[model samples]
Target: MARPLLRLLAASCALGAMAGSAAAQVADHGAPWLENPFPSTYVPLPRSDVMLRHATILDGAGNRIDDGDVLVRSGKIAAVGRALANPGGAREIDARGRWITPGVIDVHSHDGTYVLPLTTIDREAGDVSEGSDVNVADTWIETAVNPQDTAFSRALRNGVTTIQILPGSSPIFSGRAVTVKPIRATSVAAMKFPGAPYGFKMACGENPKENGAETHRGPTSRQGVVTYVRKAFMDAQQILRDQKGEDGKPGPRRGPPAGRGPDLKREALAGIMAGDLRLNMHCYRADDMATMLSVAKEFGFHITAFHHATEAYKMPAALREAGTCAAVWGDWWGYKMEALDAVRANAPMLDRAGVCVTMHSDSPGSGQRLTIEAAKAAGAGRRMGIVVPPERMIRWVTSNSAKVLGLEDRIGTLAPGYNADLVVWSGDPFSVYTKADLVFIDGAIAADRSAPPASPASDFELGRVAAVRP
Candidate 1:
């Protein structure tokens, strides 16, 4: 049933319960259901004006603006320069001697959907999978996304302003990925980053193979995995061609008519073929990565980035030649057969080869502390005798990831025209001990450690004390 009709049925049932005492008991039980129910509408809250002065700014464009003053007016960056005066009416923040950069963006994340705070029983309906099929390209992560989850707060406190949440790699073609703003809001639409393009979550190697094997599918081996992907693309190509008409004679339209057919798989492949969606493949083996690149070339689609690319260092030249970005972990190794060859210097080696490398934390626990992940990458590079400048290292999480997300024009850098998404660290960002003093999302202060929120339960100690006294 449609959501509105279901809600109407529920309301009618509640109204009908006042006929008798037993009916009144039913009404009492339904009261909690009426409080903050699903499919709730959201109105975005008003943002505050903010200004920061006297900060060491890493602009995410590999340039440093020493002692810069950044002015944010009406939720956008108004000015960024040296020795600038703040507008008199704006709220001012003193960030002297602190490192300020654009808020970090994680290209690969699974925080909101595969959440831990909610009970696991909520996912028992098997909605996480589609029709018992592994390749569910049409399913969107946004549909499963929960905006008001505590993970959103955790991610924002860790300085992540935006994230591209993807489906798990348990399938060959997992689903569509959605980019979201890390903010507490009433609905997912309120938290969505406007105009951000959707990405397709594609996988190779172990994930698809293992899933297919368990289901008695042919793709139990690496070669079988490649064949499965190739067959799907080939069918999609045929479908596209048939829709275009054979010899201009008007053949039967493939899948469904424009905006009419409900075939999710074909619609997803069509989006890819038309270049409306990006493909983010999860692969760790070097040969599998190469195969994915070749397949993308054959299909005339762009490979936006490779996630968990542990063996990316082995094929740095190939990756750079293909103009693909690598979203990899800092130093995770020996956890899987494909990742056995992973090394600590993987990120730096790819960086030195002129390949775009971004540090990604695929785990929810790790996503809450990505600054330390970036620091680990930098430290590993230094230990490997490869000297990457601190500014360049900052780009791996900020500008470079934004570039991979196709959002470089907006939120990656601290330029005048970019979105005022920034973070102020308590100390040097490269040091592991440093913490985020303040975090801003679209020029509005989202978190501040020193000054807590107006709510008494905003801090741990106050919350415990309040409980004890009661």
Candidate 2:
């Protein structure tokens, strides 16, 4: 391992020399250079003041208030309490016998990138993987996200308001992920969450190695994956180093050495080092996670979260020590060798050990019912003497998931001055029979059970994809 890293360091230094001039042109790490060329044009729907009264409220931060009242004014949560002053001109809904909680957030999803109507014939059927290289950090998943994916509406009806659309894990550094609001829009920028930091997608264990072996490229072994990742970051570090001159001062501004363009690859990687892009990794085993943590330490970056961490329960203390969250499934296990040791009590065990844990849905179907998924994990714990209350269980799908996306302060809690992105359930959120009575995004009704167009549909579902003969 040491010999390979030394050789890689030498090779990356040469590549860095060619890219240094162009890379140094970037003033602020990677944020300014990789600024969304296509910025978000998200415009919240026009909304009126709303006051929900007489409901069981789970504030998404481990607080439960019975018979509470919540006030939404001008797209923000104005107040939340057992009783609130009723302002004039606000629509009051007596939410008797209902429950309220922050809208469900799915930290890991492939809805738009890997569209439905699965077929290889269409060019847009699958845009999840960029197979050209093992480290295509220059690529952005938002570029391939199709706005007409019908899965968005299904998730919305189930109270999923925000999602991070990540790239496939076929490569060590797959690409950058885009977080977006689940809204009907003609373009991805329209649904993009304003001011949300980008996510860098990474993977270890079977997927990358298998893809490399099959494609005859990238890393074909576990150690190879770590080595390739280290090499890429090392090159990024070299580029960042060039920002300072021989006099130990900031380098003079000379935009991109003639004939060279911006190095988007290194810029994205450097973004992670600069705290601009959150790092989300796909690792199943405890050993692989530990190895990745060492790489993060060497590069001086914090991993935001680990997705599909099937064996994360084996090392709760390490995750807590590293401040990395584990985004896992409820009962998924034994399907693959890496996930063979997955136990139902993964989340509860980690929570008991003071590790931040969330229940994530990697599938389109599972994305719609994340609350039930969290309940599944909690129920498993209950069967084994680990008690999880409703107030705390709600965080796994709401605040905890929001923390993984770095949007906890804004979207995940029903607090004053926060975005009024929440759901009103007909009954207890944990019950399978109960449905989201109302779903609000930015204090506007995005989905309503008793209203017209109860479930939103995309243009594709209403036009070309609908029955033509009828």
TM for candidate 1 is 0.83
Worst-scoring 10-residue span by lDDT in model 1:
31-40
What lDDT tens digits, residue by residue, belong to model 1 across residues 1-470? 12232243334434444554333423433221121112223333467777888898887888878788888887788888888876678888789979888898888887667665445533742133332466788677778776645667778887888888888887888878878887776567778787676688888998778878887644788887788887887776543444334453223324354675455686577556545567899999899999989888777667889999999989988898888999998878898799899888788888888999998878777787776787787788899799887778889899999988889899888887788888998777777777888888877777877876534332222323445553
Q: Candidate 2: misplaced stretches above 4 Å?
A: 1-34, 121-124, 245-260, 454-459, 462-470
User: Model 2 clash tally?
Assistant: 0
lDDT for residue 354 in candidate 2, whole number 0-100: 90
lDDT of 2 by residue, 84-203 (tens): 988888899999899999999999999897788777732548988899998888888999999899889889999999999999998888889999999888899999999786788999
Most TM-score-accurate candidate: 2
- TM-score for each prediction? 0.83, 0.90
Q: Give the number of colliding residue pairs in candidate 1.
A: 0
Q: Which candidate is the best by lDDT?
A: 2
Q: Candidate 1: misplaced stretches above 4 Å?
A: 1-44, 117-131, 242-261, 453-470
